[model samples]
Target chain A: MIELKDVYFSYPSGAVLEGIDLTVKKGEYVGIMGHNGSGKTTLARLITGLLLPGKGYVRVNKIFTTDSERLLDIRRSTGMVFQDPDAQAIGETVEEDMVFGLENLGLPVPEIDTRIEKYLDLLGIRELRHRNIRTLSGGQKQLVNLAAVMVMEPECIILDEPVSMVDARCRKMILQHIARLNHEGTAIVHITHDPEELIRCHRLIVLSRCRVTNQGTPHEVFGQLLDEKKMDVPAPYAISRKLGLSPVLTIKALLEELCRSRSGN
Target chain B: MSIEIRQLTHIYDASTPWETIALDRIDLTISKGTVFGLVGGIGSGKSTLASLMAGLGTPAHGSITIDGEPPDPGRNVGILFQQPEDFFFEKTLFEDMASGLLHLGLTEEEVHKRIHSTLDLLGLDHQILDRSPFHLNRGTLRLAAFATVLTMRPGYLILDEPTASLDPKSRKRLVEVIKRISGDIAIIYISHRLQEVVAVSEYLAVLEQGKVAFTGTVPGYLDWATGQDAWEYLPVLNQVMYGLQRLGFDVDLNVACLEDAVEQIRLSLERT
Candidate 1:
């Protein structure tokens, strides 16, 4: 639902993104991976219309980001979770922050309440509903941010390193929730540095020095990146590749592959 | 010398309906020249404990002492908070790095030397010192914040989620810097990245509900974690190792590195 054609963006300091071309179809789970200062965040902002492209154009659901009259429609169709949780929190309490967005959307109070409860429970933060957003831990605050975004129920959600602040268990839970949302036809643009988190993504795009250096399925991109020693592959996939077996993404898949190979032998 | 924490309890919004125990009677010891990893689920008190240890505030019902005295953040204890770069108020990075050192009565030459040396240790060039800290990239800003802490020459360092938003290369560089410095100073390396914790820490402590759930060597914690079936909290290699063990293959569960884990799996597969 999001498309960027010949995108060029620059700040007063220097150019951040140059001649970038990308597209995210409806319900597509696209992962954007890159090193720091690679304009990944800039690209996200470009798609969300927070920062307009200096050259070329960005369109969400056929509405150009430059179209000020339709900017609200673009925002309603897409949601973005920032990397820093504290930056996104506006309300004093978790429930208040969640309701603020729904209220802005002018949804009915009953519907807003239902959405607030549903997302808090879905993210396992129901107990934190009344907690001051500032008092919560970094991980907790990040979950609240995700919940706030998901409560919007936008057509697509762009998450910027959503799981980086969370512990392993919480990371898995958040990823599962994101996957579930994507399964139900919500587009996902997951920006992260962790390769393992991209294992289940339908497509992977690697950004480097203001360019899309690589793009393909996770396996193809990771395999090529690993071969070129350009990126760090997840341990399971790396190990499986080193052993002359087809690379698998998750530990469970790696284990199954190992066992099946042994049985074949 | 070692830092000792006993019966430490910290509560937020105490005496009110919103009062909550962030850390509950936590006790631990961190010796010099060791990397002690603190890990937990969300709101498990890792950051609270780190702040208490860093002397950010006093605990409610217990004590934290570094060599028989309260932690002195000025000289002997340094903390790199989650958003450490926010603490950079000086116009230039050099001024920021020198701010803490100047309070120690060090000569200007020594302060500059320390700042330069710290930057060198982190593989940063001296040319950036004149630039505004706000102008640097996220990775550089993180390293600059880290440099500010190290320039003080603290005996104990507390890093809270140091690699949270860092890329893989930056994460590796930071880990290397930690290893190079852990020989001279004790470090409380707190993070949710289990694999990184396992790689860098000699000891591990798991917290749950503000209580210390497990604390021991990294290998011991790994075995304990596997037994507890907290596989979700394990590194990918460890999870694979645990999975292999369940599939009736004899593999080393404590294999932390990828090369070692691969070797262990290869030998186990050959034997089976």
Candidate 2:
């Protein structure tokens, strides 16, 4: 389980996250959403240990997130995929990048090979295994980034704005991959401003000034953001939310409802 | 002012073996004082087209014209990028709004007056004038970016994903602003959501595989969209409403908004 207790984060200017408390059971597919500058990214960093809380504690599985001896374990256990794919890549080629962390881990050659093969196929980037970084499109770059992290085999993945900058088709592809990961019992915490992305998760956590303002299933959080007329919630879902219906999150769900209603009639 | 492009193409990393085509032979036109929308899936060259319109990128093999002249950066074009705050480094909102006008040699007084009026137009109050640009919320920053652009008073305004990540009310306000201000300038709205484009656009273009796959009046593009698989990504409201038609449900085949669809359903029941 992951836990945050009375967490507060303050920058030099002002308090961003204040008096926040939350807990996530292992294998929970959680999503965090809010307007830009809402400190969604700050919360992600805090969980990843990229940034520390000014006050309070962040712990994973009963281990303190800030311990230096436990830091490596935290890093290994929690992987993050940021919005920009270009900023994340340090390898010249896709394959080399996927194995970069494994090589540093000093794993056995066979074990490293096994991990690399597993992630390459998992992210559907096997063809781009030897492709140059700069030549790939934004979607391809994102896929490679996901593959690189998957090769590390972390227990939890935290994605920040994963679909915001990418195109629609690529967004769908990446979102589907995340859904598949959650289904396989690997926890995913998607942090984004896109309403469509927010609705895909089983649960949502919303931050305002770095504090968790609302937390629950996507419907509940989206309900409040929307009742308050939050625009960042995917417009369609928010519109459905506005009209007082359990808005279908995907085309399949919408179609199923259409068919079922027709059959009922 | 209007925008016109013909045979426009862009090649990233030209003169290299690893070159990739971003735009290819794209032909488009935006009439004066009309909101023209560009929509497509990601990597559909929507942003590349926006760059060309904003003069941030050069078209490889095309003639581009905006307001009867070739597009030039820092000229008669004002752009609000997807992340508009990144482009701002001013200490205060007012200063940020005035920077471009000051660069253009406008008098300090003139810049100040325009900044004040534009800020009001965006619904931001005067107290925010002294507020740090970095400390503002996304909705405020999004509005501030528009305010800065309004200060320039460009003949053409290009907004890339202007409504993404905003709250519903903020989105509504932004859309209404676009509608109200579009008649004063040629508006180029680039986005992946076709529903939004359908709502505000007089004309529409869908870029696919670096080419302008469809371009015409909103109705014409809607017609094309209705016939293509591209409609699959439309909002669930549109899909459910349209799906009712496909399944022979009692309703018009194309209800984009839920309120209208609900009313239609009510009326249908009344007639029954």
Candidate with best TM-score = 1
Give the TM-scores of the predictions, in the order they appear: 0.97, 0.86
Give the clash count for model 2.
13
* Tens-digit lDDT string for candidate 1 (A1-265): 8999999999866789999999999999999999988999999999999999999999999999999999999999999999988889989999899999899999999999998999999999898988888779889999999999999999999999999889888898899999999999999999999998998899999999999999999999999899888888778889999988888888878988999988877
Give me the runs in candidate 2 sitting further than 4 Å from their true place: A35-37, A83-148, A198-200, A206-214, A218-251, A254-265, B253-256, B268-272
Clashes of each: 0, 13
Q: Write the per-residue lDDT of candidate 1 for residues B45-156, one digit (tens) a residue.
A: 9988988888888789999999888988867799999967778878888888887788889999999888888888999989989988877888989999999888888999
lDDT of 2: 0.75
lDDT of 2 by residue, A36-149 (tens): 667777788888888888889999777788887888888888888876577689889887887788888788889998888887786666767776786565556777888888
Candidate 2 matches the true fold with a TM-score of 0.86
DockQ of the two-chain complex in candidate 2: 0.38
> Considering every candidate listed, which one attains the maximal DockQ?
1
Off by over 4 Å in 1: B103-107
Predicted complex 2: CAPRI docking category: acceptable
